[model samples]
Target: MILLGIVLAGAAVCVAVGIIADNTAPATLTVFGQHVPGVSSEAQVFVAGVIVAIFFVMGLAISSLALGRSMRVRQELRDLREEREESLTALELERQQLQRELARARGNQRPTTADIPVAGHRKRDQDPVSPFFDQSA
Candidate 1:
């Protein structure tokens, strides 16, 4: 809507300027190395207005396409950031679970030989003697 308004305004200004110039001096325009015979200033103004409208429409189209492309890129970046955050959170949880398991394993350790008991012997740390062969024999 704004673009339309701008184009219309530009056309109106061009036509008004053309009318003023035509009222001031009525003359023929010269082209590239050739004279445009019997061409009025009003006709030149009309041509200039058409050219402005064409350029304005083209500019609007290019800008709209650029905006659409930028929007798509922004969305993709947002999605990628979310995925990365989720992955990082999962890795942290897995690391915490592994640390807990390690701690549990360390706490529940095996007992040493001194902690065990032999049959009818309270001195479990000392070597047992054979009854069949005495030390004096």
Candidate 2:
């Protein structure tokens, strides 16, 4: 579309110049020490300008697309890092809980002390009553 506009504008200018110069043959235009053919001047300038503009726009679009992809990847990496940190925190909490349980178990454990049972000294048939005072039997 831009190319079309440039071409139309160039044709209009050329037509005006032709009318002003009485349909003279094309001549060379020299500007800033640069010489381009006077003949076919409008077409040459319009095409070159349009091509440059198109390439510039294309470069901008490609750069934008690359930047967007890079930003998205960075965001994903950040999210993954957060998730990993949360998992590690959960594991640490679970470890602490298990340690507390183990400590409770160890605190509850106590040693028992009891004399050994003698076979011949306190037979059940010798004394049926409370045997605290039965030394004579």
Candidate 3:
């Protein structure tokens, strides 16, 4: 993109220089039906070219600022998603730890009806009650 901008700028300069060189006649600008002071055609073309260049630069600056803002927003969204996943993983680990503690407190017996997993809870292929505890102890 930088190279393309540079090439386009160089082309514009070449065109403006050619126009100024070829048109040397005296000229006057009129705005709102009022005749402005007369000047060489080359000077008028140069002023017009300067105005166009200024507007082009302004447009580029505005677009660059908008692009920067968009990129920042995307980065923030990605960071938030990663943070959310990490939080969920931590919560799941805490939940499993709590379930193990509850079973131990109940003397490691089979769960009662009230101890059954809720409908909203994710089903596991293994037994809900962990067998890590040794009843022979």
Candidate 4:
């Protein structure tokens, strides 16, 4: 919306300048030994040139603003992606650490025929039979 306003203002200024140039008589101005003549009442050509120049300048300004905005948005998105990656990495590291701890705790238990020894089996085992001791052949 602000860009639209700026474009409209530029066009208005161009038209006003063209009208003023049309009304004023030709006057020769010298700068750096170069003579510049005033533009006369040729409305069609002068107005067209003015309009073109205005639009060209406006387009350049708008393009610059758009490029800046796009760059900022891209930077923000890149930062968010990096943050997510770091969080996922930390979560995975914690999960792996927990898994290692669980494995270590399980190692303290003895193994049996079923791979899970009965609780306190050694306390009642004067001559504890193996799992297959009483199995019929």
Q: How close is each model in CA RMSD to the real structure?
A: 13.8, 18.8, 12.0, 12.2
lDDT ranking, high to low: 3, 1, 4, 2
What is candidate 4's lDDT per residue for 1-137, written digit by digit as tens?
A: 34664766576666556545554333332333433355334565465457667776676677677778879999999999999999999999999998888878998454556655567665444557687885645
Q: Scored by CA lDDT, what does every candidate get? A: 0.65, 0.60, 0.66, 0.64
The model with the greatest TM-score is 3
Across residues 105-131, which tens digit of lDDT does each residue of candidate 2 receive? Answer: 899553443244476666455556765
lDDT of 3 by residue, 1-137 (tens): 44445555565565555545654344644433444465446577468668657755755666666667779999999999999999999999999999999989998987677668788775554436556763544
Candidate 1 per-residue lDDT over residues 1-137, each given as its tens digit: 44554565565566445544554344544433344455667677457557656765665666666667779899999999999999999999999998889878899565678777757778733657786855566
Q: What local lDDT score does residue 80 receive in model 1, on the 0 to 100 scale?
A: 100
Of 1 and 2, the candidate ranking higher by lDDT: 1
Residue 79 displacement in candidate 4 (angstroms): 1.5
What TM-score against the true fold does each predicted structure earn?
0.44, 0.47, 0.55, 0.43
What's the lDDT for residue 44 in model 1? 76
Instruction: Extract clashing residue pairs from model 1.
Output: none
Best by lDDT: 3
Candidate 4: segments with Cα more than 4 A from true spot: 1-51, 104-137
